[model samples]
Target: MNQSFINTAVLLTAYDPPGPLNCVFFMLTFFLYVFTILANLILILVIYMDSSLHKPMYIFLLNLAVNGLIGCSAVCPNVMDNLLRDAQSISYGGCLLQVLFINVYASSAYAILAVMAYDRYVSICKPLQYHTIVTPSRVKLLLTVVYLIPVTLLSFQVYLTSQLPLCRFVINKLFCDNLSVVKLSCVKSALGDLYGVFIIASLVVLPFFLVLLSYIKILHVSLRASKESQKKALSTCAPHFIVFINFSVSILFSVVYNRHSTVSKYVNHLISAQFIFFPPLLHPLVYGIRTKEIRRSITKIIQRGILAGPL
Candidate 1:
C-alpha cells in the first residue's frame, strides 16, 4: 500500500471482510440505526409537544435524546457505508470529525447524566426549593455546560491528536476514536499524555463521582422519609440510574477491552460496539416505559392516532 494512502485514509480492520455475513450485519445495523433514530426522535417530539412535560426533568430528558441522536448519527451512517464498501476506511479529516462528535456525545452523556443526578437530588431532597433552584435559567445554564465542557475539552484533545504525524494507518477498531488516533502518532507526546489524563479525570471521573454523591444524599434522605415518599423517589430516579449504569458499564468494558483485549476479534468488536448500540437504543426506551408521565403521553398519542384512523 502507498504511504500517502496510508496517511490520508485510516483502514478500520476490525470488521469482517465484505461477504454474506457482512451483508447480514449491515441489514441488522440498518434496522437498529433506524429504530434508534425514530425512538430518540419520538422521545424528543413527545416532550416538545406535551406542554405538561415542559418542566426541568423532562427538559433534561429531551436534551439526552438529542445527544443520543447526535451520537448515533456520528457513527451509524459511516459504519453502514463502510460495510457496503470493499475497503473499510475513513479519511483523515473525516476521522477527526467523527472523533469530535463521538467524544462530544460521550463526554456530554456523562455530563448530562451528572446534571440529571443533581436535578433528582434537588427534587427529592429539597422539594420546596426545587423550582427555585432548578429554574428555567438554571436548566439552560446546566445544558450549556453539558455541551460546552465536552466540545471545549474534546476539541482540544482532537486538535492535539491531529497535530501528530502518523506512522500508523490501520486502526484495530470499528471506528476512529481519540486514543486510537493518538496511538498512530509516530512519536510520543508528553503534553498529549498529560492532557489525556486530565481529560479522563475531569470529564469521566468527576462526573461519575458527582453522580455517586448525589445518589448517596438522595438515599440518605429517602431512608428518613415515609414509604410513600421512598416509592415515589425510587420511581423517579430508577430510569436515570438504569440509563447511567448501563452506559457507564458499557464504556468501562470498551476501555478495558481496548487496553487488554484477550478476547477474540469478534467479541472485541461487539464489546466496543456496546457503547454505540445499547445506550442510544435503551435510554429513550427505559425512560419512556419507566416514567409514568412520558408513558402516558405516548399512550395518548398512539390512542389518538388509532381513533383518528380512516372511518
Candidate 2:
C-alpha cells in the first residue's frame, strides 16, 4: 500500500499497537487482577455472611472491599483487553469515565480508611462512650460521605480535564490516570494542576495524617491498658497500620518520583499498581491470618458448607 493509504489504515484501526512485552505484561497483570478481585470478594462475603462480623470495623472493611472492587473493575478489564488485543485506543468518553471511576474509587478507599481509623480511636480511647460515638447511624453517615465526596470531587475534575485540548491521544499507562491524561493536554492550566494537587492533599494526604494521629493516640491508650486489652488494641489496629504503610509509601514514591524525574513513567506505573491492587490483595491475608475472628469465621463458614453439601 502507498504511505498515505497505510497511514489512513492505521488511523482507522480501533486500537493502539500493543507494547513489545505485551503478552508477558498481560498475563502477569491478569493473574494479579484475578487474585485481587477474589481476595477482596471473599473478604466481603465473609464479612456479610457472618452475623458476628456485623460490627463497626467490619462494616468499614466491607466498604473498603467494595471500593477496591469498583477500582479494579474500572481499570483491569480495559487493561487486560488492551494487553491481549492489538487495539489499545479508548474512546474519549470511555477514557473520561475510567478517569472518573478511578478517582471515585481511590477517594472512597481513603475515606473508608479514615472512618476505620476513627472507629479504632473511639473504641480504644473512649471505651465507655464507644457505642454512642460510633453508632449505626454514625456509620451510615460516614459511609454516605465517603461515597458522595468522591463523586463530587471527580465530577469537577472530569469536567475541567475534559475541557483541555489534547495534543496527543496516546496515554502511556495501562489506564486513564488523571495525571497522565492531564500531562497530555496541549494547554496545561495552572488551575487544573492546583485542583489536582488539592484533591490529592485532601483525599490522600489529609487522611494519612489523621490515620497517623489516631494510631498514635491508640498506641498511647494501649500502653496504659492491661496485657490482654493491649493485645486486643494492637490486633485491631494492625490491619489499618499495614494499609496505611502500603498506601502512604506508594503515594509518597509516586509524588516524589513524578516531581524529580521526567522519565519516571515506569516507576509511576508500578506505584499505581501497588496503590490500587496490592492493598486489596494483601488485606484479606493480613487480617485473615492475624485476626482469630476472621480465621474462625472463615473456618466455620467452610465447615457449614461442607456439612450442608450433598456429597
Candidate 3:
C-alpha cells in the first residue's frame, strides 16, 4: 500500500439526505437488493435448467443476469451501509474494489450487448450459417473477450488511479466510480485522462456503434423478408434492445446529472441512484417477461412448484 493510501477514507456526501428521506432510501435500497438478487438468480436458473435455452443468445442473457448480480451486489450493500451511518463513508481500499467491480459490470454489459446484437444479426441475416458461425467454442471466446477486455482495462485504470494522491476525501455521489475517484487527485494525470477516454471509446462507444451496425443490417434484411420472418426478428430483438436502451438511458442520465451544477444535490443523488438500481432489476424483468422461452421456463417452474404441493 502507498503511504498516501494509509488510513485513507472517502466520505460519500450524497448519502446523507435529510429527514425521512434517509429511511426511504434505506428501505428502497433494501427492497431493490433483495428483488434484484432473486430476479437475476431466477433468470440464471431458468436458463441453466432448460436445455432449450442453452443457445448462444440465452447464454449471453445468463451472463447478463450474472453481471447484474455482481453490479448490484457491489453497489447496494455499500449504499445501504452508508445510508444507515451518521457519517456516511467508505475506506479507500473498499472504494477501489467497488469501483473495479462496478466498472467491470457496466463495461461487460455493453460488450455482451454488442455480441448479442451480432448474434441476432447472424441469426436473422445469415440464418443458414448461424450455427456454424456462432459455435459453442466461438461463443465462449466472445464471452471471454467481453469480460476479459474490461477487467484488464479497468484493472489497469484502477491501478493508475490508485497511485494518484487525492487532495480531497469527499465524493459527492452515492458510490465511487472511476471518473469520480479520478477527479479528486491533486495532480492531474494526462495519461490517465487519455487512457480513460480510450477506455470509454473502446468499451462504450465502439460497442454502441457495433450494436447500431448489427441492428441496421438486421433491419435491412428484415425489410426484404416475409411478414412472418419480420415478426420473428422483432420478437427476438425487442428485449435486448429494450435492455440496452434502459441501461443506456440510466447511465447517460446519471452522467448528465452529475455534470450539471444546476441540478439539485438530492436530485443528482436520486438520478444517479437509478443507474445502480434500475439496470439490474430491468435485465431479468425484460428478459423473463419479453423472451418467450425464458418466460415459459419460469412459468413451468412456478406451475411445478404449485402442483407439487398438497391439494
Candidate 4:
C-alpha cells in the first residue's frame, strides 16, 4: 500500500450526474459562498474598528468570524468550481489540504467557543473575580492556545492521512473530508478512522458538552441577578448560542450521514451544504444582529469610513 497503488487505484467508480439538482446546487452554493465571505468579513471589520466592542465577548466573536471565513474558504470555492464544471475529481494532495484547513478552522472555532463559555461563566458565576480572571493578557494567551492547539492537532491528522495509501481520491461530498478520504484508502483504514473519531469526539463533542454545561450554570446564576444584569448577560450569550446551534447541527448531521451511505444522496447533500455554508453565513449575522455594539460599530464604519484603528 503506497503511492503506486494510489496512482492505479480507482477511487471513484461512478461519475456524478450533471442534473438539474446539480445546477441548482451550483447556484445555491455559489450564492452562499459569496454571502458567507461578505458577512464574515464585515463582522471582522466591525469588531476590529469598534471601540465599544473592545471586550472579551466581542473578541471571541471576532475569532469565530475569522474561523468561519477560513472554514468556508477551505470548502466553498472548490465546491462551487466543481459544481459549475461538473467535475468531482480531487487530487490526493488537494484533498489533504482541504481536510487540514477544515479541521483547523472547525477545531479552532470550537476552542474559542469553549473559551467564551468560560468567560461567560466567570462573568455570571463569579462576577467579583471576572476581571481578574479574564484579563487582556490571559485572553491573549487563551486565544493563542485556541489557535495553536488546533493547528498542531490538524497537522498530525494530515500527516497520518498522508501516510495512508489512497485507493481513490473521490470524496462523495462537495469538499474533501477526513472520513471520505480514509474510506478511499487501499489498506485497512480502521486506525485512521478511529483516530478521526477520537479527534471529533474530543475536539467537537466534549467541548460542546462542556460549553452547554457552563451555559446552564451561567443561566441559573443570571436568573438570580437583577433584571438589568439578566438582560445584559442574555445579550452577551445570545450570539454565542446562535453560533453554537448552527455549528452543532451541521456537525451532527455530517457525522450521522457519514455513518450510513444507504440513506438518500439528497439527504447527504443537504447535510453537507449545511455543514459547509450555514456557519459562515450565519455566524456574522448572529453576532452582528444580536450585539448592539457590533451593529453600531458596523454603521459607524459605513458612515465615517474611519473611526478607530485595527484590532
Q: Estimate each model's TM-score.
A: 0.96, 0.88, 0.96, 0.88
Model 4 regions lying over 4 Å from their true place: 1-21, 189-194, 261-263, 305-311
* Residue pairs with backbone overlap in model 2: 15-87, 15-88, 16-88, 16-89
lDDT, model 3, position 310: 78
Instruction: Go through the candidates in order and give each one's C-alpha lDDT.
Output: 0.91, 0.77, 0.89, 0.78
> Clashing pairs in model 4?
11-168
Which tens-of-lDDT digit does each residue in 1-311 have in candidate 1? 12343349889998777899889988988999999999999999999988999999899999999999999899999988888898999997889889999988988999999999999999999999998999999999999999988899888888888888888888988899988888887898999899999999999999999999999999999999999999999999999999999999999998888788888888888888779877999999999999999999998888888999975
| Model 3 Cα lDDT, one tens digit per residue, 31-135 | 989999999999999999889999999999999999999889999988888887888888888888999999999899999999999999999999999989999
Residues forming the 10-long window of minimal summed lDDT in candidate 2: 1-10
lDDT for predicted candidate 4 compared with the true structure: 0.78
The per-candidate count of clashes, in order, stands at 0, 4, 0, 1
lDDT of 4 at 71: 89
For candidate 2, what is the TM-score?
A: 0.88
C-alpha lDDT (0 to 100) for residue 75 of candidate 2: 79
In angstroms, the error of model 1 at 103 is 0.7
lDDT of 2 by residue, 22-79 (tens): 6777787789899988888899999999999999999998888888888878877877
RMSD of each: 2.4, 5.2, 1.5, 3.7
Whole-model alpha-carbon lDDT for candidate 2? 0.77
Give the 10-residue window scoring lowest on summed lDDT in candidate 1.
1-10
